[model samples]
Target: MASEAAAQMNFQTMEHPAPMPIDQRTQVLLTPGFGTQFTDHMVSIEWSDTRGWHNGVIGPRHPIQLDPAAAVLHYAQEIFEGLKAYRHPDGTAALFRPEANAKRFNDSARRMAMPELPEEMFLEAIRLLVEKDNGWIPEEEGSSLYLRPFMFASEAFLGVRPAKRYKFLVIASPAGNYFKSGAPAVSIWVSSDYTRAAPGGTGAAKCGGNYAASLVPQAEAIERGHDQVVFLDAAERKWIEELGGMNLFFVFDDGRVLTPALTGTILPGITRNSLITLLREEGLTVEEGRYSLEQWREDATTGKLVETFACGTAAVVTAVGRVSGHDGEFTIGTGGPGQLTQKMKDRLTGIQRGLVADSHGWVKKLG
Candidate 1:
């Protein structure tokens, strides 16, 4: 299988002579704001039809040389994954379920008609980057090194079929908090004018096109003074799908939690999955099925829906305090983070930051 091939390829490390100065880097790391600051180096691996995968290198972060007719620029054949490397309280670096990211990345590749990378290769690339750029990881509470691993078609020919050549790279970012509000909750805009994905479309795939299609609606949400945009099912435009970049969850007054079922149109979020397991462990009745926006409004109005929140790698878990659209607006649970929402966020974040016991074996400690 592809995994067997990946085991044979050794990652070659290249020297990066000019790293950021200690004083300057320390200052930047002290107040690193999300993805705005990057580390000194990166990891890259090239793939082709004739060679499978070759020319692996961990070197200085630099501008990539691409052909004028590169397939990624023209056809947009690209996919990416996001996860964080945590600096534990014990002064060690670790990752949360990175193997899960590798599996999802390959799933995205299969959907995009791209080559499947070996899981071992994916993990090794991440390990290499986290180790090389160890200094970029912020030690402050709620801050970590964000890892972005992406692949794109690089063949120069302008053909309709999949490109024979491809490139996979991993980069790191020092991040603090994703939301600038620093509030216990976030506001959402119901995007009735724009739909993120359709049935049997690339919605399930974590590709660039799915995000590209959401930018306009997301912009509109921001213009209307919302933190994020909530999308409805493309078919009926009635049932809830997810947020622009995260998955939605609804908690009931009766202690039941409901999230949209994966109907091949929603990104299967790792954070969402982890929270589901954690909720179930606490004996919660978790339901994965269709939940219409009308039902959401009715439940919130009648005090049936206790809380609403979204989950992702970047935001972790954020409560949905307000919802608005062209139809009207509504508030959920006094327009603030509910008790359960805050509890869930705290538990998940605790496990990720290595403060609490990791019973699920999700944390992979690094150097």
Candidate 2:
């Protein structure tokens, strides 16, 4: 049924009239700093209660016009997904685990009470945009085209109910390394005053509000000279849930790994899931269970916990070198990128960029 609906949903293409010149684009791609530079084109689709999903367009990247009373402006009915298009060695482009992203996008929509987009339709939108703007993909070693697909309530109503109209848009950004600190590993600051999500809240949803609620704490972390902020469970305020925008993992000395269980709060990260599979395949014990702040400090101090890392789509895999909060600071395994962390990052990135064989068939090539 979703394949049938996707086949019927046609996208009208309109090329950019005055796209960026080749030389200028090359310069921009040379050092495309994360999300600052954008591609020439974007994808847009509209949805409504009566019309369903219609009016699909692949056109120039432009500003979005919204009514003053739009529900998204007030109620924050928005959800989004982030994935990347990698330029392989053979001059071809591919996406890693895009199907996972599509599924997660719908999951977020379901949680936010927004209309679910067909998985096939979601992939089709991404394919159209990537193919149309293929030239924007950076050829650098660690660079790719970052794709952001987002949906929001477009209906101009002040009511407290779900909006009847919605709009979905996909934009491409030429991205480089997500972190600019050039540190061997990133330092994290534990947030004691602010929590990311409650048990029945939107923590698991990739909505704007969850991130908005994290801004103050994130700023506080930065002010304290940390790269990222790690949040604790709202109820206990001791169990480590996740970082501001990534997931956590603890590597132990006994060849066992543990990540905080997804208890309706932590975002089910695709990178985190893939790493678990890879670790288990490598004959390592992987466990998904609650890890507390007290336990983390104790294990690190006692040499039980050797390496800790954070995973996500943007940062891929980054080791947690130092942890600091009101209680004090502690170092994890020489306070540098651990050997296991580097190995996992290399393995994951190798599979992503086609340097290694993809036995899991996670990469979807755009031909």
Best by TM-score: 2
Tens-digit lDDT track of model 1 for 1-367: 7678777788888888888998999999888888899999999999999999888899999999999999999998999999999988888899999999999999999999999999999999999999999988899888899999999999998879999999999999999999987887889999887899998899989999999899999999999999999999887889999998999999998999999999899999999999999999989999999999998999999999989999999999999999999889999998998888889989999999898899999999996
Off by over 4 Å in 2: none
* CA lDDT for candidate 2: 0.95
lDDT of 2 at 131: 97
Where does model 1 exceed 4 Å of error? none
Q: By summed lDDT, which 10 consecutive residues of candidate 2 come out lowest?
A: 1-10
Distance from true position, residue 32, model 2, in Å? 0.7
Give the CA lDDT, 0 to 100, for residue 74 in model 1: 91
Give the C-alpha miss distance for residue 307 in model 1, angstroms. Answer: 0.5
Cα-based RMSD of candidate 2: 0.6
* TM-score of model number 2: 0.99
